[model samples]
Target: MQQAPAKDRIQLVDALRGFALLGIFLANILIFSGWEFLTDAGRAALADASAIDWQHRFHKFFVDGKFYTLFSMLFGAGFALQLERLTQRGADGLRIYRRRVLILLGIGLVHQWLIWDGDILVLYALMGLILPAFHRLSDRALLAWSALLIFAVPIAGVLTVNAAGWPPDAGLLALSERVAVALGAVNPQDGVTWLRRTDFDGWFSWVMSGPIYSWGIRLMSWRIFKVLGIMLLGMWIGRRVASGSLLNDRRLLWRVLAGGLLIGVPANVAYTYGKQWQTDWPSLIGTVPLALAYAAAFALAWPRAQRVLGIFSFPGRMALTNYLTQSIICILVFYGFGLGQVGYWPPAAFYTFALAVFLVQLLLSRWWLRHHAQGPMEALWRRGTYSGRVTRAAAPG
Candidate 1:
């Protein structure tokens, strides 16, 4: 809710966030549409197998988990930046952050239950608590821990999933299945009525299955390791940015750009074609490097591309509002309560929808920012964050 002056604002960060929002939409629409439910034959019939398969490769290479990685990094950077302001003002950053996280947790739960199951806010809120622990660490020590956290668990998980579909123990598998079954199955009859045709019964089915389908399979499956690590890495980068080490070193940026392209490209290519055991696991881990490549590429280009890419600052500025609105728009478009066209659209067509929606959001954001300083959700979050805090003059001398 606190607005920075235009001159002081970091346009590149906003641009990166805006870019990531678009990418997140592209990455997420697949699951939201229930597209995975399509039969192999059904998918083939919808489009030429080669064309559809190529689309899959395109997603894997450029889209897939990359945006979320960028988003998470930005989250860490934002937190670090806020801590600096809080420090200068002699405010307790941890206390303010705790309130902010709580507010986010409440909003995230509401979002998850009503709009979309693929919510990251709840997880971010949970992980934000852990960040204070790192705030006092030396830069080198922080980076070391960040690297270990980001790569170790995910790599191990991938290897485990590749060798055996994770939780390799028969007893554990059976227990998890029992828990999942107890939660319920996502038997939506078909993709058409899954959201549209559902009366109370249909709604109830999804609600019940949320634990298994949404939380268990979605969160516990792999996202935890990925999210936690990326956040830590983001925080580490945040510190560097705070100290001016990251932005000042063009050589470092070049190294990252080169490494991201040189290393990330082939890793993504392998990820696209390889099966679960061979390349799938590695691909998941590779998303981070590729995402970094994207950030570096954009940062390098932003100076030249400002007018063209600067447009991203709109949606990026009101990210939370826009993010939630995306789910609302999607629900209205694809669910039975609305249009119910969920899986009816092909991949290319879905991409068009995402782009169109984002464009509209951009225009709306522009209009809103012209009238008001903060997005509605952001305003509420800020109020909560600063609630009951003593004013500077009121503090002890």
Candidate 2:
């Protein structure tokens, strides 16, 4: 008997993803304005008595770290759904997946160099290359690997630094120095380099030639292991309960809520004060727990979210297009190729700009999806991979 088609592509997951996408914009607003907003000295410059203190505090408390964690969880859930479709096809899932990931790598490389400084698509694509290896692992094995990756990355980082006899605070100091130089008021050179990077060929060069041969491969390799672990966790959750069904599982929801609050709240506090206090270990520890708390909370809340976050579902359904469109809009607003407003706008203003972009995309996505089956990029990917021919025609909704 023929198995029925997958149910209209998991509505709640899409909504959660859309919700995550909005948060991602909040996380990225600073970077979108200019590269300087994220650096230490830039933040210090923006944190004066005349600066908008409440806004900064709000962003730090609500936007930082939280949204990225949300995005990663959605990525994990999406990866599981991909594996389900592939496995049912009885094909070489890994080989096909590798090709798709390579395409994504190509897309990300272009996006990173041409668009913004905080591009995570390249990282995601790189992670995709190795996720298939863990696709077949048992739940226990998957959990073990996830735990190892989470613990091993930072531990390994610290051990390697120690082995090299580097100063305990060397990395942080160097980063601080870079920021200081950039924000020194008279350092025109640093400002110029920063602008050129975001506006010209510098981004392309960095992605293509600069150190891709060095730590690039290693970073991608490690991220793969990390992402695979997350993907397995999502799969485990999905297999345990069907969509809309998890809402009734109050005991599980309570467990998730507790785990998230227990870890997430404290970690966030530490991440905030620890940075201010210049305590490296606290920041590192806090970041890890925060990542876990994110997964736990999302897994718990998804069932309850189905009704609350309907608007986000439309955008999430067309995530690829929406994501890419964000870059397009940012370039138009800030690049030399467009308005060239680098170093001109404040962090708070950047967020306002991001909000406008979000609203436009949200409306556009809703309208576009009403008439078509896939977002523009998603349609291209479908045709490119399956037909080996580029079909420009959009699919009907």
Candidate 3:
């Protein structure tokens, strides 16, 4: 595997990644803290119900669906950068890229089975397989295809399901029943109960059994298309970055930032309220714009706020490690076998806790990079990609 030298690393991208990680942690903590599992009645029963209600609204509007999109785009950008470098070296880029992706898939599987059920790496790896096909497409073509996947497909599916009353087959229902049985839960309530009361063994068993069925459902629902579309957009951005146009184009950045905010803010508000009301259209339509706006805002601020934003680059540089570490830490904190503090804290407390955890991670990441070139998981990924012949590139500056 060809690694970018530390000097060549894009600090802005790393910072954006680091920033995305923070957002992801904030978002995931809802599930990790079991706040997501609480029923509307349960939430209403909280002593800080008013605060929780507003906090949740804020989260749904600003946090949910936005950071993951950013991260996916970054993944595509990384793919673009790697493919370009490989081609420049006249190597068999496709073969090497496939090997790298396969390794990532393996890592993702292990993570999903052993760590967190909300893992995105598996989906990223799965979606990544199709990215090579788009590599040869023009930038305009890439954007066009991305918009089709992101907007058209999902909208069509929603319309079809609503209009035709799509039904779950008996086999799918049986599989879900089997999954629940495997996790020692017979229904949604039982599942939440099991999640709250189970020991390490039971929890591990749930992780092993649940994600399989969950992934199947996601696939059936066509979530992969949205993810793929975002990745393609990332690839387009990466190409611009590689060409040195995106970094220098202040006017373009301003336009993107302005447009993203103007459109994204209201759309996300609609998405938030729509979700509360169980409407799907706003979320499907709003996620990409808000996510893009966030990216544009970050890019515009990076140059002026380097001293502050640059701190994020440490965690961003070892994002794989940080991401996995977050799952492990959250599991330990919230799962029954550990602290078992799930569903106890208010939304505000969880937000503070997420920030605290990320701060610690930032420090740990900085320290680890001082001695090693990359995070442990990244090292393992590189080794697997290179068939045990990995080179130790210097850490990002």
Candidate 4:
């Protein structure tokens, strides 16, 4: 087999990635700024909804489950692309990918410690460890395992609830209350300070002193499984589209969306309805279907959206640098590390800030790419992968 040229990287796929990056940032702003716990009046636009504490309701309807699901699905696609390249070169793709995941694990740990505890990179790294093992499974097998694994944790949780019932385990409940209380006590303006303490002392304490018992039980639970399932779906999409086989398939694109909506909308709605039952089973069952819908919708969106959202391509091209930059900016704006405007900025305000960041990134990324081969992080990653073949890009003067 002829080796694929290095310059053959697809622009449309990068554009799609950038679009997913933007969606991720929008959903993440709430968690980044600590607005996830704020009162409805503190953020919502609707007066009646705010009065009734409709924050979760609104988030669920829009950002909550949707954007992150898109992001995770993209990761899966990315993995497939990577493996395809390695396989074409007759290299051990799994071995190479594991090294990369190890590197990511280290990066994620640093990110969580110095930046934010909500870092998904760490989760991705942990999940990536098991992914290469599933590379060759038939699509149906992949889908089945994806569904089963995604639901397993939540189902187990539901079963535990059935067995134990009511207000949670006494010991766990007490610990959760303590953690919640500490988190609640921090004023928004003190977010930067919170970051330092939590990222450092809090993280260290949890890693060293937290029970192995908890980790053992929850490590492969539903949340992790759902993400893994998404990654698997992404692998399928990446193999199909990133490989350039689907670009000319215009009819396939519409079919993708129609099928996704047919399956996704009803599944997501059913999942939402199940949530109203106030039990774990309904949510678990509902989430299983919604996960499938999310994968389909994203795959369907890409080829169709490319021509429409081509401009976002550059930012997606530099995703690593941009993702890290977001953390840096948040630390500067909300923490004592810089301006420390945490609690003062409501959730709605983050949307404005996010827009500003996006605009700046979109312009800067395009500008940088005009004069450079790759983003700084991509260059560094290349240097890591190729040994001495290339040098890291120097920081801008």
Per-model C-alpha RMSD: 4.3, 6.1, 3.9, 6.2
lDDT of 3: 0.79
Rank candidates, lDDT, best first.
3, 1, 4, 2
In the range 1-397, model 3's lDDT, one tens digit per residue, is 2333333348889999999999999988988988877877676666465796588688878887889889999999989987877777666677778888988899888888778877889999988999999999999999999999888987887677668876423145457557656656545444446677655556755686667655755655557888899999999988888767776787888888888778777877876553452226667777778888888888778767888989999999999999999999988888888788877777778889999999999999999999998899888887777663322221122
Off by over 4 Å in 3: 1-9, 167-174, 216-221, 277-279, 388-397
lDDT of candidate 1? Answer: 0.72
**TM-score on alpha carbons, each prediction:** 0.88, 0.76, 0.91, 0.75
Task: Report the lDDT tens digits of candidate 2 across residue range 261-329.
Answer: 676566556555423421244433454455555545654565456455667778888887888888788
Give me the candidate number with maximum TM-score: 3
TM-score of predicted structure 1: 0.88
Off by over 4 Å in 4: 1-9, 40-58, 165-221, 242-256, 266-307, 388-397
Pairs that collide in candidate 4 are 76-234, 76-235, 77-234, 153-222, 188-342, 188-343, 189-343, 192-335, 192-336
Full-model lDDT, candidate 4: 0.62
Of 3 and 4, the candidate ranking higher by lDDT: 3
Q: How high is the CA lDDT of each candidate model?
A: 0.72, 0.59, 0.79, 0.62
Please provide, for model 1 over 1-397, each residue's C-alpha lDDT reduced to its tens digit, 9 standing for 90 to 100: 2333433247778878988999998877876665656776767767787878877788878887788889988988888877876777778777777778889999998888777766878877877777787788777776677666667765676567657765423244344444434544244435444555546555545544443445454333466656666777777777766665666566777888898888788888887884332225556557678889888878767657888888998899899999999988887777766777766778887888888999999999989999988788877787776657453322223
Poorest stretch of ten by lDDT in candidate 4 = 388-397
